[model samples]
Target: MYLSQVKSNGKQYIYLCVYVGTQEYSTRKEKRVYSFGETKKALIKMKRWKRKFNEFPNELLNLGCGMENLEEWIRTIETGITKTGRIFKTNVKRAVF
Candidate 1:
């Protein structure tokens, strides 16, 4: 199973929980971001990976530290254009509706 959540800091994180090996539960997750999904799935996936490697991979996940598309974000910010930007802009339309 897979699960995801948006964090208070405005980041999206995903976790996977599955029984991939002899283990009955497993879990995988972003290192930092939203962290520790609200469900049991995350634990399940971790167990699976643990069983597969017999140890942790000893690597770091993106953990949602940087924007997934930093360049696109930069372009939008530079152009002062984007759905979110437009919506949040201070304008007459926003003041009325």
Candidate 2:
């Protein structure tokens, strides 16, 4: 996973881009991006994410932080950053619809 920053309408946004494919198909790997909000808050969360799994290998095959676990982590984030980003309640239906 890596942190990606983008600028839009004079504001900066950060995202956590995770490669969801195995190394066997490096050329055609899939990617999922989870938003971390604007620069100030996003930077703080990005640092947290890096520190969370920094020990894992490029393939994320470490015993504690395997690829599967990483995938689950991403899922929870997409469902709601409150599950991983920050502490706050979200209106799920609105977010989805």
Candidate 3:
């Protein structure tokens, strides 16, 4: 997602755009755009959206350390044990892959 500013007849407008999908080079890409009246309101909405979606799950970070198997990750979380014997008080959630 991104923001775009437009000027028309000396008036400024803000737009919030999301990239929805892609297509072949010969076809147009899919996107969604929302208009937010002015700079102040647009900025506030942008901040809220950022706070809502910018969070990364900690379990996802663990994937880099050889926890590529979902079942193993689930067991580790349930038993709260690691190779170093450290207990992780993790609140796991259903995450999309």
Give the winner by lDDT.
2
Candidate ordering by TM-score (highest first): 2, 3, 1
Model 1 — TM-score against the truth?
0.22
lDDT of 2 by residue, 4-92 (tens): 45678977665556666775746745454456577555444433555675644453342244545554444443444443465322222
Tell me the tens digit of each residue's lDDT in model 1 across 1-97: 2222333454333332333444335353332323344223333334444345433233323323222233332233234354354521111111110
Candidate 2 matches the true fold with a TM-score of 0.34
In the range 26-49, model 3's lDDT, one tens digit per residue, is 353434355655544443443444
Q: What is the C-alpha RMSD of each candidate to the true structure, in Å?
A: 15.8, 13.5, 17.5
Candidate with the greatest TM-score versus the true structure: 2
Compared with the true structure, all predictions reach lDDT values of 0.32, 0.48, 0.43
Off by over 4 Å in 1: 1-31, 34-36, 54-97
Q: Could you tell me the C-alpha RMSD of candidate 2 in Å?
A: 13.5
